[model samples]
Target: MTKNGHRPKIVVIGGGTGLPVILKSLREKNADITAVVTVADDGGSSGIIRDYVNVVPPGDIRNVLAALSELPEIYLDIFQYRFDTSDRFFAGHAIGNLIIAALAEMKKGVFASVQELSEMMRVDGHVFPVADEPLVLNAEFSDGTFLAGEAEITAARKSIKRVWVTSNEKNEAEMPAAVPEVVEAILGADQIVLGPGSLFTSILPNLVIGNVGKALAETKAEVVYICNIMTQKGETEHFTDADHVRILNAHLGQCFVNTVLVNTAQVPEGYMDKEKYDENLVQVEHDFNGLREQHCRVISSNFLKLKNQGVFHDGNKVVEELMGLVGRPNHELRHREHS
Candidate 1:
């Protein structure tokens, strides 16, 4: 709620590229948002910090902060800068990663640093790492073999059979305490968005969080899933929009989703040839017919457009479609003030 007194509260779950994009779009609608990001990132700067610091992985959390940022350009640029020199140890680190690491060291916690940074960024909505504890995601194959980390699971030649969080005998799985705020947002929300990212790694990791999952299941908010435009190489090689819903249901079980949003526009053949995207590998063809077969309502529109050198939803179009799902007006009043 703000001075003028009107805005929808929204809770979005996922991480990586999709979560940030969705957050950016929703923020444009002036919705008060809380992004519950996956903490299972074990690649690049995030994995390095998780291994050394033993705190919730900060990389994905940092990305979400940047996406939600509505600040000046210089500050945004500085936050995203990555050291690319031949200095092997720091070569792949991002400026935000180091800032977060230093803050964690000074404040004695990851969430504390995130809070400070969030304030500095003047983010329109709040962001939360799915769990405060460092959670290592483990993958298990049907043959009963276990892979220890996200990287290993990705690199494994065999397709991932299933994934789960790992913990010692004495502890139980739990979301970071901040997660209840996410639930509160959902319970009060007009809409809840799931993902446009990796099914297993980005979206499901957050969904499987203890209370977060239950809150989503029970919330009266209209649940909407922004299906991925392209299937991920190792994770969802041949998935369709319907396949996305099925996988979410498979992991979270039935009734996990109510509506699925898909791109109705067809990709140009010339563009596909120019980009050399593996059409056979994982393409999102308009398949609402297939999606409806899964017992979920399907809404399709021309959501795809070229942006940032890759295809993405014309953010405005995607948000408009989503708002329509819950009977909200597609107007600038989207960012209405609250009393």
Candidate 2:
């Protein structure tokens, strides 16, 4: 609980592998968590499912649900199980993704379906899709050329100028608006977190939703951006920590980020398995001065955890810093006592 004896309300807005890592840690904290996940994914199992099923991509949402679930490990393991290549019909698709897709079909909307599933799974907190329908992520490259679809954008291997989302439905006359629950979560949050994911594809896709961006800019909560530890090859190559913040601010036309969490611990030479984690190019260089110019408080720490020859944020350390920012210095101690 917070100093005032109420659980702090935190809204984490992003998608991809990073969001779930933080959500798993946040589940143990004395906070009311709301994960506003992106619906713009169009790759691998998600893309194939979207094309055939005509539903919002469920891969990221499936992961987030698993992270916050209170179900037994064995049940979750089964839910997360993926078919082998030998099973050609269901190959490469996780059972959880297929479940979410089925629910979307039955419920008639992704947002409502997620809520129902969250309850059945005994999720610790809320999981909201940024929009009710699938959104196609479109980008304008630095060379002034345009590309549509997340997969193609990344495959082009060109510097991205900016990105936005459009309705995947045909003849849709309006830009997609975020569900009321998502905007309410952001506006009522005690703290809001942006990203530790792909800058343009994962994070921006959600923010580019008109209402979501408006709610973020109007929210009174402190917005904290968890900067990516490594630069992504196709999206943010040769970028610094401040460059990430700069692009975010440029997209919103305001410095919405109040703080930035940066990883200072360096990966030893030849530590990362390049073949496996090929998307990551190098550690994100710091530009404290640039961050200062954006009026963001820079919190530098060894928020690094290397495992399986890959680099990632130390979830415990990141959540510790976040709890402190939310005025819960004794939260860890209290949690330990209870445990």
The lDDT leader among the candidates is 2
Q: What is candidate 2's lDDT per residue for 68-184, written digit by digit as tens?
A: 999999999999999998899999999999999999999999998999999999999999999999999999999999999998999899999899999998956778889999999
Supply candidate 2's per-residue lDDT for 93: 92
In model 2, which regions exceed 4 Å deviation?
328-339
In the predicted model 2, the residue pairs found to clash are: none
Model 1: lowest-lDDT 10 consecutive positions: 330-339
Q: State the C-alpha lDDT per candidate.
A: 0.72, 0.90
Task: Give the alpha carbon lDDT tens digit for every residue of 57-175 in model 1.
Answer: 77888889999998898998889888886878888888888888888788886666787889989987887766556676777775678787777786774566777775412364542
Best by TM-score: 2
In model 2, what is the error at residue 322, expressed in angstroms?
0.5
